[model samples]
Target: MERSSAHRTPGDPVAGMALPVYIVCGGTGGHLAPGIATAQRLIRAGISVELVVSEKEVDSRLLESYPDLNYRRVKGAPFRLSPKGLFLFVLHNTRSFISGFQYLRKNPPAMILAFGGFISVSYVIAAWLLKVPIVLHEANRVVGRSIRFLSGMADTVFLPDGVSLAGIEARRIRRLGMPLREEVKHVSKETIRREMDIPHHAKVLVVVGGSQGAKALNDWVEETHKSLASDGIWIILVTGPGKNQMPELKVLQSDMGVDVEIRTFAFHRSLHELFSCADVVLSRAGAGTVAELVCCLAPSILVPFPYAADDHQLANAQDLERRGGCIVIDQKNSSNLYREVLDLIFNDWLLGRMRQNLRRLNHGDAAENLTKQLIESYYPGHLRATAVENSTEAKEAVNG
Candidate 1:
């Protein structure tokens, strides 16, 4: 069998110079966060990086704080089965491919690392045409359509634990854990409680509804907050930054009276702190969220978005459930949501057991490990040595 493109011979430029890497992780925060975490690892190791993302409002809001990194944007739409939608998908993809090809031809990187999404399709195609090594990481428990279509062409495929990707050669897939931010690894529960000004003994519940709040989940939480708060459970709700008016949090606090601590924020940049302090989490089953929960050892009640691609979020949640890391609550029968939440909150033994299971499921040092593998797989040792040396000299010159 022919080796994947990643095993192809390296060019003199790639072998002798410090070449930048292009990471395509657009669409949602689930795709973007892992890409950013992996890119951060490469950057700290003296490699230059460029990020290609979709020109969506959510992307802009999530990426606005990372001014130190380079970024480029393209317009993308979800795949639709209708004729008009298909035509638009083709037209947008063709334009994206042409733009990507033009840019890479002018300023090519040594490789492209793609996190699955429609926006990444064009970037992967452009890199393949340029003969740059391509690596694909699919964070979903089930393979996404774009990645499934493009997998045969990738040099390597990386997955988070518990993904049973069939058809692809077992040799081609490696479980690299989830690419997570450095901060996700180091949050302290004590520090988080202090920062949020919570009493030391108070039990904390965190509600995560994705980048835009899940209206159903928020509504449920709103209706049940008074009872939960009265039981001495403090709620930290991340409603996301949407145009919708948030629940009257202050009024809710008044209704619950001083005994309950109910704090609401439209968004929080440091979600690790929130997760770190959580006794239990109520959240959607996005791959990034599950991975973060595992890292933080937070047991959760996962509500999968019923409309997600191929019902993949359901697959993610079920995998966690099977592993004893979480309990799955179907969106359709969410009438029992409060009961489930209360059960987890009140049952210390069950929560502790789930936490133990979650810890066993974590993939340690994911970003650092993946960075080392990418460098070793695609670049020769001398190239890394030269790159580091040149980077050191440049820094020294700037300082001097």
Candidate 2:
């Protein structure tokens, strides 16, 4: 359960009491949501918060809801596809990292928390050099290149349940559960279904391509949808707006089996309604999205983005399957042919078992778990007393 952030105000003793600040580095909602949840927890505990983000949507649009937050647009996230691309990505990332180091000279945090993305790499590096406590989080089963590159730099690295950190030092790692939306944790299913306009009599299937839409996934849904729609199944497909919305989809809607509906826009922060109305979810295996599924106890058919970094998404799905909360479908396999997913959705037993298993994987308090750890790490008497003290002095140096 999450404590509300509304308690923080300017003059009230309960809200105005001076508390040491914490810095979070992330931009994308995948990373930012966990950071935001953690920050809210710290704030309610009477700590101040600062967010250092890349100059991207991950920060501005996602973190816009919190006005008291101190925001800084750092470097852009990196994308590397080839040898030359990798070199340039590293060079730019290093420059961003140096900038993060300089920021520490003025406004050092008690400790730094990261959701493991390009934007966080610099923050971790800067924290390490300044000898401030640093914690890094990986929301997936398989750690990505960013986490791998900087894991050694952080004082501790936390993961969502079920990940295997094979080569990393055991002393530095711990398995914390996934952070979930506070709203989703307390949401009323009855109200959510009403908001989504989902019918009560129908078993709902939600197909999500991602924030930018997956053409291949949408194409597959288009091919087998009519038959499922003809049955009693409600097929709600989210094509992810902007680029994926098809003018031709009107024809698909026109030729409807009467049970299919499609949508294109949804707030990234408040996606609980879609999950609430869904009996089954079909989506790519991004760590953040899969964590939301487990948090909601929503069983899903996982299709890893075939081209995701290091093929990490596929590995994330495999871990969920090992935990029995999901079924993995590799896009490369012919067995994953178009109708296969629709068939799985129709398999009442398969869907029921996955939903039942998902309950076991629910960490409903991942944010709480991590926030508690942050409090321990940042407290003056904790194991990281030196880091906390040094960080305080660094910030004082900046304030002076």
Q: Give the per-residue lDDT digits (tens) of candidate 1, residues 130-225.
A: 777788998888889988877876778998766766678988788877788766763677887888777767778899887766777777767878
What's the lDDT for all of these models?
A: 0.81, 0.67
Writing each residue's lDDT as its tens digit, candidate 2 over 1-400 gives: 1112442222223312243444555655677777777777776755677777777653666666777766677765476779988887788778888887887756666667778778777777777776656677887767877788777766678976556666667787888866764665524457767776766656677777654467777777667666556555566666654445433333223233454555444334455567767777888888778877877778788889998877888888888888888878877773465466567766779877887788777644877777776666455343245477789999999999
The candidate that wins on lDDT is 1
Ten-residue region with minimum lDDT total, candidate 2: 1-10
